[model samples]
Target chain A: MDMIRRTVLKSAGATGVVAGLLATGMLKPTLAYADDWNKAAFEAKNMDGALDGIGAKGAADNKDLLVKAPEIAENGAVVPVDVTSNIPNTTSIAFLIAKNPSPLAAQFEFSNGAVADVSVRLKFAETSIVRVVAKADGKFYSAQREVKVTAGGCGG
Target chain B: MADPMKIRAQMKGDVAEVRVLMSHAMETGTRKEADGKLVPAHHIQNMTVALNGKTVIAGQIAGSVSKNPVFGFKVKGAKAGDKVAVSWIDNKGDKRTDEAAVA
Candidate 1:
């Protein structure tokens, strides 16, 4: 633990120097390391809007895209969801919840021979269908599974 | 500034299984404080995973993700001792990057 903390501190210091360089314009910011945050999709109020934001509104349903999640969750704050896409040339995967205030949860773009399987922890506002969408060969495919949350993740 | 992420990478046959646990508050603006004041949204906005300095996965997320988010991924063509780096930039412009070697 001590070693880990020390390492963290060392990295933090290094980042601090990097930040300083960036602030002083010594290091030019490059687009290579930056990715655009999908604002329209993430802030969408409904699932359909979220789907549209990600250009998956009319995505075809495919069984090859598998969504594995608990059927019932006691706590909505941290529900584990796993996705695997068997589609050939799969390039990206996205998660959308039907009942969250903003339905879009996350989206991941894969490349360079990465596997199309991922596991992530998400929050569900209530009972909702968690949708997984995969983009392959310029086409989109999706799958969904329902999860019942006894306790709400979003606090009132 | 944010806490460092915990990353683990292991060779599972021909693939490298990488798991990352990030420390974050992930506070949504909807939630209120004890005094009933709405908490400002603070969460990870974007993340990237790199293998030996090459990006393999790029992600964008929202506050709907749970606090201290955990994620797992699989990378192909990776061998033991190869570097795997994971980094994220949050809504508040806070960022953290951590790396691990496939074992």
Candidate 2:
């Protein structure tokens, strides 16, 4: 018990030091964690570019990957999207709005026996194809659904 | 500062259905305020979920997501009485973490 307490205290002290460095601007905020935000991927203007930015180029269409989205979104500002993959050993799932100024919307990585299921709300600039890409077994599979946005979400 | 996320976890059979509601403006950095100045990009950049202290989902999000984003996922082999913790870090370095008991 004494050893565990000491270890915990040491970790706490280390965290405090890191936080202090961040507060003083000595350390970049993104470097505080292992996972860094991929800004370029999310800023890509086209579907292919976005996929390439995320190292998911040449993804093949697969029926096992399912993307569920509204056929017609009354409010383009908030469209619900859900994706599920039946493929085994799925590692990641990413959503893209093909017509948005920036196509990549969200990307999720799964581990520890988590199911390949994700639901998120996305914004659409206009009528666009909602695409979902799943990485499994070192390969990428994709599925898409067209969602007609009656109103634009990017502009007033 | 942002409001704490609301997380719910329930065991359906052996699967744990986790739902999270994150309170954020999700500003795209393009919108103009009343003063006609562009609002800087401020959105959740990363999210994580853990079941019984084991990470099950890690997500990277962008400003294209809708405001007050809602996310849902499923975790296999999760049982009642387990703990489900959800956390998110925004682009501005703000973070919030909240947990729920599996039911």
Candidate 3:
């Protein structure tokens, strides 16, 4: 089980060099990526800002959305989270960590008959509520699950 | 050039299940190094998945994602041998794209 998750781990030294270059103004990131990344939402500082940035401030809670995560995460570094929306015509799904510095962790827009299901790993600073919000037929619905982080607990 | 992304695509019934592992540091820009200097933020900001050259999943990822992020998604109407491509661009302007055939 651990081997599966650990498979992606590799030396990050190359990325560190890129970071240094960007910091020193040696390399410039193209503005072309701005159209795809949601800067407003990802840079939002608070929960309210995050919700507003995603345009889900008044989202209604729904049971059709499923958020699967470990009740207690032994490690906060790589907590696996899976989300599935049974609601018809789900156009998008967004994952938000209630207490994260930016709250809005990730968001995916689905189209061309793509299923509104996704699995991803997230880093948690501490125990926090994992919120899943989905948009279907122009209406926003949400569901949340609390994941407890046990410090020093072993994870397989 | 950036490291190649590991991509796997398989047909689960009629839907194609695509999973990808991107190589990144996903720095939060708030962490302090041993020298007490802030680590600059460097994370995947944009990602996209395409089935047979058609867009299926478009996403925005942040530093909150774990390092070497793994993502799984399913696409409908995909058949065996169909092409699946995954691509991403980080905040530092680094980009990577890899493709796999659905089996």
Candidate 4:
């Protein structure tokens, strides 16, 4: 069981590199990607960010998306998260941390008749915005919440 | 190891309540040891739950979850003694599958 979990963990870690793949062209650019559903703002410290990083600036009133994080993270090293969406025709979802080593956490895309709920664990170096964004039909919508990281959880 | 996933299934009328506890360190690739070496990022990537060989739930994931991830969902028209299977594939292509029957 440990062996299996270890493998899963290692694969889960590959997103940082997969997100980097577009930059190095280790993989082909997503020529088929649609712009409206593909957000770019939330990705970087600046505008020229990765497609996965962009999100709507504010979604305080968007009623379809649900974001959950502790008001205070007991361990900054590993924080728990849960996201769910009830928006019609939802096509994508993403998670971003305003103050991680990198802002991007993870992103997911849904196909025909897919469920819009997800949960995962992440690392936070400090207090940051926990943003969950969703693309519905042809428009982008998002919600940002804050998390306070107390102690670090990385191997350190 | 954080903790082995806790799995449970119950029946109330025709509803089945299924739950899972997955063990994961969920490292975010942004920390260092006392000696200052960066710890690699690790997390669970994909998970699917099936009822009696039919797909019921599937989701893409990343490392933004807590240690020992837990998820519960509802299934309609399920009966007691039906077999429900859960499978997970992490970022590195490691996959594990577990099954439980409704009681």
Q: Better model by lDDT, 1 or 2?
A: 1
lDDT of 1 at B1: 66
Candidate 2's residue-wise lDDT over A66-100, tens digit each?
Answer: 88898989898899999999988999999999999
lDDT at A72, model 2 = 88
Output the better candidate (2/4) by lDDT. 2
Q: Candidate 2's residue-wise lDDT over B17-100, tens digit each?
A: 999999999997777899999887778888899988989999999999999999989999998989999988876567888999
C-alpha RMSD of each candidate structure in angstroms: 8.9, 7.6, 8.7, 9.0
Model 3 DockQ reads: 0.63
Per-residue lDDT tens digits of candidate 1, residues B26-103? 986688899999897888888999999999999998999999999999999999999999999875567788998989
For candidate 2, what is the total of clashing residue pairs?
0
TM-score of chain B of each: 0.97, 0.93, 0.96, 0.87
| Candidate 4, B40-63: lDDT as tens digits | 766665667777878666655545
Model 1: per-residue lDDT, tens digit, A27-87?
A: 3233223237777788889989999999998999998998899998988899999999999
By lDDT, who's the top model here? 1
Tens digits of lDDT, candidate 4, A74-152? 7765677777788887666777776664566566565423356666566676788877778787677777688887664
**Which parts of model 4 have CA positions greater than 4 angstroms off?**
A1-61, A89-92, A106-121, A151-156, B1-4, B10-17, B74-79
| TM, every model | 0.85, 0.86, 0.88, 0.62
Which ranges of candidate 3 are over 4 A from the true structure? Answer: A1-29, A154-156
lDDT for model 4, on a 0 to 1 scale? 0.62
- Please list the residue runs of candidate 2 whose C-alpha ends up more than 4 Å from where it truly belongs after superposition: A1-31, A152-156
Per-model DockQ: 0.45, 0.57, 0.63, 0.29
lDDT for A151 in candidate 2 is 54
> iRMS of every model, one decimal?
3.1, 2.0, 1.4, 6.6
